[model samples]
Target chain A: MSVTMDKPPVADGAPRPYTLRQPRLPRWTPPALALGAAAVAVGIGIGAGLGSRIQWGLIAGLLFVVGMYALAARVEGRRQAKDRLATSLVWVCFLLAVVPLISLVWETVARGSKVLDGGFLSHSMSGVLTIQPGGGVYHAIIGTLEQVGIATAISAPIGLLTAIYLVEYGRGRLAKAVTFFVDVMTGIPSIVAGLFILSFWIIMLDFGYSGFAGSMALSILMMPVVVRSTEEMLKLVPNELREASLALGVPKWRTILKVVLPTAIGGIATGVMLAVARIAGETAPIVLLVFGSQVINNNPFDGAQSSLPYYIYEQWAAGNEASYDRAWAAALVLIAFVMILNLVARGIARWKAPKTGR
Target chain B: MDITPATSAAPPPLSGAPAPAEQAKSATRPGDRIFLGFSRGSGILLLVIMAAIAAFLAVRAVNALSHNEGNFFTTFEWSANSTPPVFGIAVLAFGTVVSSLIAMLIAVPVAIGVALFVSHYAPRKLATPLSYVIDLLAAVPSIVYGLWGALFLVPHLGGLYSWLNDYLGWTGIFAYHDGAARSLFTIGILLAIMILPIVTSVSREVFLQTPRMNEEAALALGATRWEVIRMSVLPFGRSGVISASMLGLGRALGETMAVATVLSPSFLINTSLLDPGGGTFAQNIASSFKESGEIGKDALIASGLVLFVLTLLVNGAARMIIARRKEYTA
Candidate 1:
């Protein structure tokens, strides 16, 4: 390389300079090209009388990618152009995915805010007619809370114990079988879980529709999520901690109960709460099991109940403008509720992250 | 002796603590025995629940299948309450498969692109927040998506649907007759959007775990950025992406509210997706549950049993792929 630079290279009959320099586009090239593509796309869209700005945007994006690749290849060679093309496509993909998400949130909040007020939150739908406007999700809120609370109560302990069995005491075929079936159980659809309870509790045993039945189905869905998350958290508790406790002559049970549980409690709680958040939004199971009611049913064990998600479905099915507004409001409440749980769960995870200093 | 250390850690032993005779067995102390039993019982209980779900669904499905006057697999109408009840899953099965197929086709490529962008293309500051947003988006409930799809998306999709019909109507699948945009095609798009976040996050994780040395070696060899990714990253992440897509497909197949809310259910199978006349199993069960009698409920359960088995197969395939990939990596 030094010899080539010092003395010019002789190619065929001509002498040429041997320098390590390649032609490259300026940093502003992409943005400038994109602006040109947008202008051209908009001009064509206006001339052709395209109905949607989305069509124009798609045209602009396509032009930008093609134009960038052509100009880059001319100046900077094939490899650099290919790289730029890939980067631009990735950006396009990112924008495409993000736009709908933002729209979904923005639409929900904008429309949901119209009917979401104190009265809307406090009253039940019992007195309100399906075609008439004013109603609230108070009954649904009560039903969701009770049903989800009961589900959490039933599943959290069993899930925790199952996770403990897998992590702490698991050995041989039983443990392996438990682990395999847990993975299988995780994939059971919420509707299928409801169907299971439907066949068993409602049909076979001749029981009436109740939120308690919904809770049973929910626990089925919740259990696997809980077990998976808790198992991960428990695994994060270093084996050294367990060994340390056991080396002190502490019994195995005491070591697990005192040392391990305390160490992982924050993570365990976070997992449980996240699982609750997941099951709380479930509508399919509740639709089949709780058998949604219009009035507030305080007793989850005795009668049919409504939930936030179920209310949304029911209101939407009513298919009127007023019912549509109520559905939006309920959806807003459900999103906010689930988001809060998620934020708090993540916060707990961070606050109580194991300080093993690994 | 073990009891002594454990009890000594506290100020006082409880009155219900096991007697000395029971505690004398060091390995089989009453506390250990009971805890083991309790935890093991919980594990066994989970297995039982899984078994019970399959057993109950299968039994009911069989019972319903036996009483059908029409061929259960061939009949198109779902009237379980009629005399000599006859209902079949031909249309439901067709609708479910086609809608989920459409969803998978649209979602998988876009998800891989988003995953690649988050893992490799975006700057660190941008990548972190972008991925966090994706994570939160995944947690957004499907019912919310269903509502949004019904109210917002259906109305807005008119132009695009017309555009597709105009350009691709020669293909029978894209034909449209100026009907409401509540169709299997629309449901497919909604399901795609709903499952995108999950597929993207999983693939992003796999892309992030691509061995750094492999990537750097390609880079050091003067390969372009895209070449480096193509040679080292995509190959390593291929199985991961496949499994991620399978997971998304499983979700799309079993999704209820979004399809139920978006698609106008009809018992007949339609050749054109743009026509609002196809019904999925989950959607059928959901929309039909309200008015169904005992026999109707039993029929819904039978359809749900099919859905359960379908998801199980998809999920099982995904798990197998993941398990195989693990062995390769290890």
Candidate 2:
């Protein structure tokens, strides 16, 4: 490198016999060409009467990839063309995802805001018929809060204990069986959980549709999530903490309780919150188990109740303009609630993340 | 009494609290005993719940199946509430498989591409937010997706469906009589969008885990960036992508409201995916449950049983695939 530099700069007219030549496409060419391709694709889509933005995007994406490769092959070489194609395709994929997601959120906010004033949040559909316009998610919110609360109350402890067994005291067949089943349990569909509870609590035992019954199925869905997240958290806690507690002559259970749980509490809380968030938006279980009510029912055990997701489904199923408006409002509320929970959980997780500096 | 403190970092207490090695060593605290029993009970209870779900669903499904007048696998009509209760899963099973398969086909490629984009192509500053937005997409409820599909996407798809039918109508599958966009194809697209985030996230994680050393090795061998990815990254992530796709497939099969909202339900199976009316298992259960009588409810439960088994199999296979690759990857 030093010898080449010391020799001197070559003039433009020099033959440059020792120089290696590897021609490359200009950096801006791909993006410019991609933009052109996208324009062409959209024009074609419109001319051909393809309505969906998805078709337009797909066509644009294909054009961009192919165009990038062709331009690169002409300017540089085949290998370089392949490289450009991959990169452009990847960009197209990212854009394809971004478009729908942005549209979903945007569409929800725009449409939902029309009926999503304070009245919508504060009132219930007590006397409001399916076709009536004035209704809120108040009762549904109450039911969601209660049902999710009950589910969390039931699942968190059991899931925490199960994780503890798997991480700390687990051995042999029982532990293996528990771990395996937990994976299987993680895959159980929310509706199947509803059906399970339907058969077990409602069918065989003759329990009426109630928020408590919904809680039962929601707990089933929440448990494995809690377990997996808690297990990961517990695994993160260093062995030194447990060993230190034991060295101090602390009892095993006390060590776990005082040392392990506190240390991992942040992640555990995050996990539990995520679990709560998961169940809060669940419609299938509540639709079946709670048997959504139009009026408010404070008591979870005795009677049918309204929940946010169920209300949305019920309203949508009604198939009227007013009902559609209500469904959109409910969906908006549910999305906000779940998103808030997720953000908070993630915030707590990041904030309370264990320090590794020591 | 033997204390094995040297073997493990801490001495194992057979019970929760051991007294000592020399005197009354076998003695344990009752608190330790109770706590251990409680925790062990929780673990055992999970197993019990799984077992109970399977057993109960099996019993109920069998009871409903035995009472059916029509052939379970052949009949298209669902009339479990009527006298002589004629019903079958023929249409439901076909729709579920077809919609999910279409979902997988559409979702897997897009998801893999998105995963590759995030892990490989995107700038460092851009990648985090893109992935976070995608994660938020995953968090959005199925009901919301269903609403969007029904309200927003279906109408927009009319032109696309007509185009497909017009251009590719020679293929019996694309042939369409009506221009209504409420077909299995629409449901499949919605499901594809719905399942995209999970697949992308999983495969992104897997792709990111590809060893930098192997990537550098390819790069050092005069391979271009794409060649490096093809040689090292894609090979390493193949199992992960498969597992991710399977997980997405599991989601598509079991998804309820989205399919329920999008697809127009009918008893008959049509060859044209562009035509509406075939129903999926979860969708059928969800749509039928509210109006159905006791016998009809039982029938829905039976189909729910089938959906349950199907998801379990798909997820189990995914887990198995991931576990098998763990040896190589780790």
Candidate 3:
């Protein structure tokens, strides 16, 4: 029987039929592919066995999935599966680390919100008992304001001037020494700052526990932060501005005051506020310096004044449910204040960032 | 204009003399020079403040030393209230070092892992939010950490402590006592958690700065993703990791509230990690300052001086390492 074949018509002296070719495999391909796949599977099996406990199960599962991918790739193609597995593993690790942080914030807000009320803000622990839960952090808040405010007042100008001198007028041996000391101070433990202030002011000078002592402790901690931040900000003020002011025959100090500082004021303010925030939640130094008090002490130089940190410690350590509730509320308040300060600092920085384009 | 022209006369310098107007403008006034001098004097004021802090600390520390009765370095006992006072920072120093080392051991690996995960592995959309969460952790006050450790972690760690004791009892470091509620291990763990965010943030930034070309080349060579990270990103960020670790160490060494809350104070030094004793320098100061006698306060001050020196040395080393890396980069 004659069968009709669909074939190309010859343009020249060529055959009209087409030929089918056989697909040939390389001799080493199967064994190499099998070995790689086996190795991956064995590794994953071992990992899975070792990682049966904890979240290691997740890792074991991932390794097994990768092994399966590798085996499948050996049949289809090698590169595509490897890429897919690696990408998947990366995502798993990212999510694993992210979960705890969200949980922590969520827990804090949920637990801390229960006691956050107006009554919690306006009164002190003076009237409330262990069972009753209506006291406020008025004394602690006031003390915190007074002590931290005094500390800022003491630290800001000194730190700013030091930074100004370092960036503007400093060049020689003394400047180097100042820089060295400032670096040392930056590393000094908050406890050491407290000890330094406590020893010098209280033991040596015979001044007892007070908000002033806390301020001194906070100042020691705050100064280094202020100096570092301010120095960075001042350094960022373009050198051309300095030269311009100099060319105008303005005095160096006047140029710094009128031109340089004014230009960098936004950054300087932000830095100062950041420094304040950095020290506001410090508990160690204040614990050492300030005495806990239920009643607010108006004057910083008086005896036994309570700060927010001290208040938290006192309330929590008291071991009463009511006091514990108050402590949580106070913590919430402190955290909110610090958050606000940080936001403000960020805003100032964004607002004052030098305009580059028209 | 016409009146001015009528009154105008030639004001010219004669053969070898200068006009009074020229002389008046030629030299700077002494007052101006004095003002310049005063302005320079402000720099001196800065120096003075710096010197004053150091000087004040030194004097107080010296006073503490002179009044102190026992060998401040070797003696483990801290009996500051006795008439013939016998106390030392040996216990405190040991606690500080041990806790900080424990913290570093826990924090370093986790921090690097997290940093690597975020910078190299995390998707673009997830990275920012993850970093913001870390920032929030950093912003949470130390006292909050203290409360969390005290209320939640301490109670739960008992099981873990027993497990450590059962499995790792041969090693003195992991040995456990009955009371696991207030122990150095808990303090160390809390400190690790507290410093984790700082190290992760800094190291993440550093890892992010790794040269993309090198990473791409490694990947192009058929290297695994982790292999590329090991070969390119880690080497690039080693100095930064070291710096970040030091910063974390600095915080861990000085951390007060968390340690204070987690630990139960004891005078004697115990090697067991789960023992509810061993006070850190900050904890000692915080716990004792209110009730301490004058000599006791001085003793605390003396220990604080040691911590100060230790931290200074640590940060100085970190700065030097960072500076050397900058030089290499330059």
Candidate 4:
């Protein structure tokens, strides 16, 4: 073992000079480069009279990436340099996305908080002029509630049944076609649905504008969402449960009704509510179909009606400071309503997830 | 319910079913028959609705198109309510496509990065809440975004537009004339923000689903984290990312209130994106609905048909990609 090879590569070496560890930049290198890049960007911005902080930030981001690549390449290797480039880009992307979203929420809350009050909530824009401040979303809220309620009532059962058919009984070409069309249905723009109802309900049948027409369109939008979500939940039900019920001489329909549905009921309710939340904020279809009214219209089947979203739109279109305040306030209420529904839907999913055992 | 049972019973006697079929059918009770019929009918009803939407829209669109004094595809002016009812979709098509193109250009790469950040880069503690925030962002309704865009984003974008014009005005697209910052470009940015969450969520799911073994093998070869992702994750999720972007594009094309709120509608197509004038199909429809006559309403319906078909193609292609990817993975 100790026999000396005269031409050994490591001649006269105590231990090969090579080390397993590569020469790595210090951990502080990234932050240091970022700070230097920021300084340079600020300098360039001031010198060039840049108007937007966005431009400065973009320059700083670019400089940081370039600097990081150059530094890492020199100290470590090209691979590490590329990795640093990717890391920086990903971080920048996250920051870019976060900015607009935060601004949206913050602006809505800040501007909207100015006019939102009990009086604003309880009164209607019935007698008030478009440019004045004295009005509320009371009628709009009622219209939205009734229209959305009817939409849910119409769509939920049909959507649920469609899902049940797809998951439980779907087999051949008809099922496949239904599935494909349902996917396509989910992509129908709200306005197209409105146009469909408009042509059919008003143009063909000669009915005037009513909230019922809007509800029909909203139901069209809600149906596909409900079907998709409900189908997923239904597919999660255990086959063995159905088998066990069938073995006990329970009819197949009864097995589905009494055994399978109860198991998935929590998820089904959540899906329907989420669908409701989705349609509740739709404004485009309502503008065409409902023919928004300033005063209360309790009967959705009657003349023109306004919903919360339509109210915000109508107010904003009025183009006055007072109208803008009302729009913002209504927007705040709408957002709050939507956010609560989302939270509750997710909460229900979390709470019921354990019982499903998947 | 009783009517359904009666109809089912009526069908059985005429078919003259075979023995095993009859036995099997009898084993299933009337309740099963009715339930099956009802659920199946519901599925058929959905198909019928889709067909009706297409058919009815076509009928109205054709009626409007026939009466038009101007070329439906080429003419720029829209005076559908006027005598002879001249209207066309040239400007609306340009605005819709250009705005959505800008939206796709900005949104797709950023969405992928956000997806990667959530799936790989972020700390575990940060990732959960970050995605939650994104989900909330998606749930924030479009009208709220419109309000924010008009009041907050439109005002704030003046500086950025000027900066862009200063550097890139020679390109003509970025040229700004110091007008209100409610151009198609502004709507593009707003649409990008709106579609970001959906794109991110879809891409994140695909990225997360990349096989653990492939990633681990790359890492075992002394690959850095980013290298591992580039080698193992991105290739697998490429189609997913494409489909996600297409889905986002579908959304951007049909988006109504946000664009309607932000863009100052005019019938002319602007060479510079920084200009305040131009219209989208959906936006034109919404803005003109109030002032139009019956012919105008039909003309708006005609425009909606174009949006509907365009979105359908985009979404259909996206779904095909997803379906193909599913087969490959399975």
TM-score of chain B of each: 0.91, 0.92, 0.85, 0.93
- Cα-based TM-score, every candidate: 0.93, 0.93, 0.81, 0.93
Give one digit per residue, the lDDT tens place, for model 3 in A39-58. 65556647544322223334
lDDT, residue B123, candidate 3: 77
Ranking under DockQ, best-scoring first? 4, 2, 1, 3
Task: List residue ranges in candidate 3 displaced over 4 A.
Answer: A1-100, A130-132, A356-358, B1-70, B177-180
What lDDT tens digits, residue by residue, belong to model 2 across residues B206-253? 999999999999888878888889999999999999999998998899
For residues A1-358, could you state the per-residue lDDT of candidate 4 as single tens digits? 1232222324434455655455678989878888999999999989988867777888998998888888877766667778888998898899889988887888889989999999999989989998887899999999999999999999999999999999999999989888888888888889999999999999999999999999999999999999999999888888889999988988888998998898888788889888888999999999999989989889999899999999999898999999999999999999999999988998898778525554
Residue B288 lDDT in candidate 4: 94
Classify candidate 2 by CAPRI docking class: medium
CA lDDT, every model vs. true structure: 0.90, 0.87, 0.75, 0.90
TM-score of 1: 0.93
TM-score of candidate 4 versus the correct structure, residues matched by position: 0.93
Q: Which stretches of candidate 1 lie over 4 Å from their true place?
A: A1-19, B1-24
Q: Which model scores highest in DockQ?
A: 4
Tens digit of per-residue lDDT, candidate 2, span A20-87: 54456777887788789889988998898676787887788888888888887776666677788888
Model 1, C-alpha of B312: deviation from truth (Å):
0.8
For model 4, residues B1-330, the per-residue Cα lDDT tens digits are 576887777666756767568668655679989999999999999999999998999999999998999999999999999999999899999999999999999999999999999999999999999998898788888988898899888887888898888899999989998978999999999999999999999999999999999999999888888989999999999999999999999999999999999999898889999879999999998999999898899999999999999999999999999989989889
Model 2, stretches more than 4 Å misplaced?
A: A1-21, B1-27
Candidate 1 DockQ, CA atoms = 0.63
